[model samples]
Target: MSGEREPVSREESSTVAAVQEEAEAVALVPELLISDLLRYGVLLSLSLVTLGTLVTFLRHPDYLVSSEALQRLTAPHPVPHGLRDVVVGAMAARGQSFVMAGLLVMMAVPVMRVGLSLLIFRQQRDTVYVAITTAVLALLGLSFLLGAAE
Candidate 1:
């Protein structure tokens, strides 16, 4: 065979380019999803916190209690109890509960992103990444469980 190579047709070259572009787009889906999760999660959390603050100030213009009194009241129990209690209190228009819920939502965003990554890795049949992601998820779950037990 001669050392010279045959020129590829325009149609063939376009088809190859299209295939590459499609592959690149498919690969970007997970990244895009993660970005959206972070963006929307922060926005939602900020909205909740802002709404809660507005409602609190509107409902109690003079403040719920004196700053010193509030500090004394909360100093004994700095950390909140559980999600159920927070949700119930928030439903009752408790400003602190609303803030707590927003914080929880913010914390959950990264966990959700990790979960999505695990799913994407599994779908792509990437065994190494799937295992690593699973381990990370397991550690996260364990940390939550341990914290709750305390």
Candidate 2:
């Protein structure tokens, strides 16, 4: 044998290319999912805040019908709050509550991205990314816990 390989057929080459394309698409699933999640999250957050603003302005010609309420909303010093507070306020259908909830959703998106990444990496058997994403997610959780303590 002169080390010459067999002549490649066009059909065979196309089949191989198709398989490779399929694999590439499969690999992209995680990325696509994450991107879609982030996009939707931002949209949802924006809509919530917009709705809250409209509701507040309409309900209280001057935003909650009081300058104090507006000041509280725009205060430089963020009032330390909890999920329970947000939930309760939102349940009351208050504009401020919806705005706060929207902000909370915005803050949560990145954490959720990391978590979703870890899950996808694990599912795809990518050990390195899984470990890295897991650590990131853990750090995020720790920070939230520490922040709540303050």
Candidate 3:
């Protein structure tokens, strides 16, 4: 306790700091490259599925109903029972169509994240930053998809 310690060299100090920073990043799952890859892939897949649904809607255009129109159609009416079924079906389809559209948009979020990751890596070659960015993109995309489904 009485003896003075020698000063750390600049190189040694910087290396130790770098190592500590890396260790902290390693402690977070989202700070790993594999995590980012998983997110990017999942988002891309969800978007594709959504796009497919949109295409199906396009092919079956006769059933599509805007929200305003659906509300109007669902209003109580003194119509034949069969006609009521038609209105109800249309209302359901309207919601499904919107959900599919939202999924498509959500998918784009992951793709955008991938691009940002690449840019970050190019600028600094830091895997932790890439992983974090990708993870964020994935979570946002998933949230969008889930919200849209509802």
Instruction: Evaluate residue 4 in candidate 3 and report its C-alpha lDDT on the 0 to 100 scale.
Output: 32
| lDDT (10s digit) by residue, model 1, range 74-141 | 67765666888889979999887887888889888889989999999999999999999999999999
Predictions in order: lDDT: 0.85, 0.86, 0.60
Tens-place lDDT per residue, model 3, 26-117, is: 66533466466657766665765565567657766654855675566589865322334534533566444444444544555556657656
Report model 1's TM-score to 2 decimal places: 0.79
Candidate 1 local accuracy as lDDT? 0.85
Root-mean-square deviation of every model: 5.5, 6.0, 15.2
- What clash pairs does model 3 have? none
Regarding lDDT, does 2 or 3 come out ahead?
Answer: 2
lDDT of 1 at 7: 45
* Candidate 2: 10-residue stretch with minimal lDDT: 1-10
Clashes of each: 0, 0, 0
Better of 1 and 3 by lDDT: 1
Clashing pairs in 1: none
Candidate 2 structure quality by residue, lDDT tens digits, 5-120: 43446567888999999999998898899999999999999999999888778777865457787666687876529899888888888887898888989999999999898889
